[model samples]
Target chain A: MEFINDLMQYEFLQKAFFTSIMVGIISGVIGSFIILRGMALMGDAISHAVLPGVAISFMLGINYFYGAVLMGVLAAVAIGVVTQHSRIKNDSSIGIVFTAFFALGIIFISKAQTATDLTQILFGNVLSVRTSDMWITLVIGGIVLLTVVLFYKELLVSSFDETMAQAYGLPTRAIHYLVMVLLTLVTVASLQTVGVVLVVAMLITPASTAYLLTNKLWIMILLSALIGAFSSVVGLYFSFVYNLSSGAVIVLVATFLFVLAFIFAPKQGVLWRSIRARKSKSAA
Target chain B: MTGTVSVKNLHVSYHGKEVVKNISFEFNSHKLIGIIGPNGAGKSTLMKAVLNLIPKDKGKISFAGDSVEQVRKNIAYVPQRSDIDWDFPITVIDTVLIGRYPKLGLFRRPKKSDKAFAYKCLKQVNMEEFADRQIAELSGGQQQRVFLARALAQEAEYFFLDEPFVGIDVASEKTIISILKKLRDSGKTVFVVHHDLTKVVSYFDELILINKQLIGAGPTQEVIKPEVMNKAYNIDFDLLNQMGVGV
Candidate 1:
């Protein structure tokens, strides 16, 4: 209860709270498409691949956002090129490219001797989010969220049916690259809240939970964002009261929601499926 | 431009292997045309190449005597049913509304008229009742009709479908063919990759027969000759030869 009230008393706590919520909203909204397109592994790949970008950015004393975004987009493009040019499938391409980038990141960090801690980069320090970081999250999150809004229809068709989108002269390839770019932006925003390793989970879990609840894409997106934000706020409280890692607790809360949806969602859940199965058995 | 499509000396290869080699045919007349071939005959590949969905190793596809680029807006292609992931969470209304996407212009959602038109297409395909349901929950035939509705919403002059009848219910097949016939009668050129030979004469006004290269193409009655049939199927058309027109 005291933790919940800390928002009114502590300005830093408020910054952490708002930053995590913004992170949740971005994750939920963009993650809907990621899960819908079966790009979970791709999300995982891009997040992991951003490490090298961060390391280089730290080494060069540049804003980490620029480097991470650059690296993430490059990694995505590399994955696309590899899959398209070779016999290697998408999953294998992602695995090969991301791991190499990640290895390079490790090497860069080891040699740089910079103050940028590897553990901090890998696992974020959400509790220490400054006012400036909060503003950065807001700007980045707003841009991506607005982009998603502007291109909702384009993204829908291209993601749902690329061939058909192409038939319409929709520039499917360009749209694909644009999606990768936005994903990179989203990943960079997430890096401060959930760190690199847990970023994909934040992106995928809430969307997946919403997917279990609804068949409509818009509804699923709405549900996902709401669930994501709720989890963030609740997780922030839990972290405050228990002195737990905010990022880890946030992810756990999101996963808990997913588990709840998986078991008990009315539209398509294990419980409902079993109930339907048993009803058929009784009828027979 | 009015509906007409021409494929000239088209060659498609994958991994250094020729899938479709030296195929050329001119299809006009704004009529329903069936592209029939045995499995692995590159029928699907031919459609994909013509639509520029797959890169053709060599050759040109023209529409209305122009390169495909100028007339691309007039064309709509529905790939095979198996090519899609049905489990994607999109409602039927939205799926059909995607047909309007090409016409929707930039940064525009489906407008009121688009919604009405999508609903109208659903009605035409007798799928209006299922518009709100998730597409994956529907049966195979219903799913095919939903795709057809989407294509119809495109309002294109040239329609290309890969196996519209494969693995679908008879009612859906009938509905789809009727819709195609209507489109043709309304002066839209329709091209389909078809497999069933027995119903060829009944379904299409023209037939494009192929193995890898073009075997014969023209009015269905004139092109289903025994030699052409033999060339396409690698079997003596003796059985079809006995039915009169094969010879």
Candidate 2:
């Protein structure tokens, strides 16, 4: 009740709340495709790759979104180039590129003259989210959701069977690059809420939890978005009451939901499988 | 429309190794063509190169004088079962609906007619009962049927299947071979990359033997000779006799 009153009273709280919700929804939506495509490591790479750009933007007295998105896309392209041109596998390429960018980001952050808080960028301080960041999050969120709706079929086919998709002239490579771009934009939008380090949790945990609950792609996506939004709201409330970091709290809430679903999902849960096994065994 | 495919001097390499070397063949309509070879003989590679699914180092492939791009919608490919991720979150009907994507093009949703047609294709493969089931919930034979149903939904003129008989039950193999025969009788072209040499004479009307190159291409009776089988598989006639081939 007090949180609701404060949410009504304070403009910063309103911005943070709305921004977090948008971040949650878009992360869950795009994250569904990422995990389905087996690109969860790519998602983590793009999020971490945003850090050097954020530090550079702070050094240049500019908004971090532009730099962060640019770095994210560059990192994605570099990973693609390395994997395609060399014998190195996708996971190794992602690890090598992301860690280099992360080290560069640390160097840039230490040399920054301004009093930019690295902790906030690492773990997010959503309470101090700028108004412009909120607006940017809304725009990115809208683009991600719209693209998913328009390209759901293509995404589904390409992820499920790339060879068939390519055989049917679907331009599977182009679709892959487009998804990478969307991941970059999603990483940029999520920076103000979950920050760089914990954004993958926001992207992956909710979708994985939803995966346990459903067997259809559309239903999984919808449920994942809902779970993400719910976690964000509840985490924000708890963060406010306890004076905690909003990003960490939100990630914890998402993880908590995942735990619940892991044990109790109706069909795919471990407990459900055990119960079915016992029943069959008794019948035998 | 011309219902023939011609390939001249086709070459396909993987990771700088030539898997399919200087292969060329001509396929006519209304025939169930079998691509038969030993393991690592580039049978799948040749099929993929012909379908333009993978890049060819040097090749001139024409579909009745039409380019692959011009007739892509008319082509349907069923890759090996191992290539698919069965645990993916998709329903059987939805998987079949993917075939209609080529006809629907981009930015358009599947309509009632499309759904009805997908159901019809499912029924054709006797998989309509499993339409709503998740793909992972299916048996190996059921999964292959679902894929065949998806190809049927494509309403394609040319069907390319790679190792369709591998890792499937005898019932599935019979069902799939019957479907291919039916399609061939309807004047559509069907190509199967088959590893099982015993079923070659019964399953296909024509055979294209390859050992990283074109060993022979002719009627099944002519291509299944002892010398040709020896050249393609590099094995003795005694072993071929053991595999139930009366060569």
Candidate 3:
């Protein structure tokens, strides 16, 4: 009761809760696409790659979000262009860029000797969320969610069948680039609440869990957002009570949900399939 | 009448080796042509070259008397089933809805009329029931039907399908043939890259026998001669005749 009272009274905690809800919705929706396209690792790569960009901007006294977004977009485009134009495989290209950027960020952080800022950027301190950050995340999340819904058909077709989309005279290349850009925005926005290390979990876990339960894309998006929101709230409360890292707790909760879904989901789950097979065999 | 599609002295290379040699052909809007060749014959590469999907070293392709870019909207292509990832999380209805994307322009959503058209295309392919089902849940034949439905939804006058009949069941093969026939009947020019020599005679109205260069082309019966088969398949003409695939 005391911890609950503390959570309700703290302005920073309120901001964290509100901002996480907004970021959860955005990450959940976009993350569905990322998982379906097998770009889960790519999302992780972008999140890590933005570290150097954020570090450089912070050192130069620029806004961290702006720096992160710019670098994230550049990294995504570089990966896309390099993989498409050159002989390098997609995974290798992502690995190369992400490692280089992350290493540079670590070196820069060590040089600056700003331990508190670096720790916050990497691990996140969600209790420090400001009203400005909350409002920005909300606005950006709303725009991204609306755009995704509006262009749902185009994205589905391009992702499923690129050649056919091209043959129909659809600008598949443009859509591909646009999707990468949107992913970068989502990653940068999410970093504020989930931090860089755990952003990939927020981006992938809910969607992957929803994917195991449903085949319809729209339903998957909705369900994923709900699950993400639920995890965020629960994890926030637990962190407030236990004095744990909010982002880590949230990701751990999501991963637990994912494992549960994997084992017990109706159509595709391991336990469900095993029971189904046993029943059929007994009947035979 | 649209401008002619002319390919002159085209050469296609992949990884620094020539896959398709210097070849030239012209197609207009009046015929349904079948590109017939054995595997590794570079038929797909030639088609891709015309579409600028693959780079060509020394070729000029002009469409309907216009450049490839000028008439990009006038062309439609259907890739093989193996080319797509069927496990992708999208409904059959949504897949068909993509046909309207080019016409919808960027940042614009599909309107009601566009969805209605998509439904109509699904009905045409006898796949309206599977519209809401995820693509991975569909059978191979049904998957092919959905691809055909997507192509039909494109409503483009010129259609190219690469190996449409591969791995499909008998019923699907017949359905696809009828669909192709209907497209031809409606005055849409269709080009099919087909492999099965057994059904060549009954399936295609016109034939293009290709082995690096145009071996023979005309009506099906005229193009399926001994010399053409020998040249295109590099097989004994007598063997092809014994198998009832060549004259």
Per-model TM-score, in order, reads 0.97, 0.97, 0.93
In the predicted model 2, the residue pairs found to clash are none
- The C-alpha stretches of model 1 lying farther than 4 A from their native spots are B240-247
Q: Chain A TM-score for model 3, please?
A: 0.94
The C-alpha stretches of model 3 lying farther than 4 A from their native spots are A1-4, A282-284, B243-247
Could you give the candidate ranking by DockQ, starting with the highest? 2, 1, 3
Expressed as tens digits, the lDDT of each residue in A100-163 for candidate 3 is 8889888876776553477787877677787877887887788888889778877777777777
Q: What's the distance in Å from true for residue B125, model 2? A: 0.6
Candidate 3 chain B: worst-modelled 10 consecutive residues by lDDT? B1-10
Could you give candidate 1's per-residue lDDT for residues A1-284 as a string of tens digits?
67767788999899988998999998899899998788999999999999999988888988888889999999999999999999999999999999999999999888877876888788887778878779888998899889999999988888889888887688889988887887888888877778899989988999999999988888888999998899888888887788887779889999999999999999789999999999999999
TM-score between model 2 and native: 0.97
Each candidate's DockQ: 0.80, 0.87, 0.59
The i-RMS of candidate 1 is 1.1
Candidate chain B TM-scores, in order: 0.95, 0.96, 0.93
The ten-residue window of minimal lDDT in model 3 chain A covers: A109-118
Compute the DockQ of candidate 3.
0.59
Candidate 2, residue A283: lDDT: 100
Q: Model 2 scores what on Cα lDDT?
A: 0.90
Best by TM-score: 2
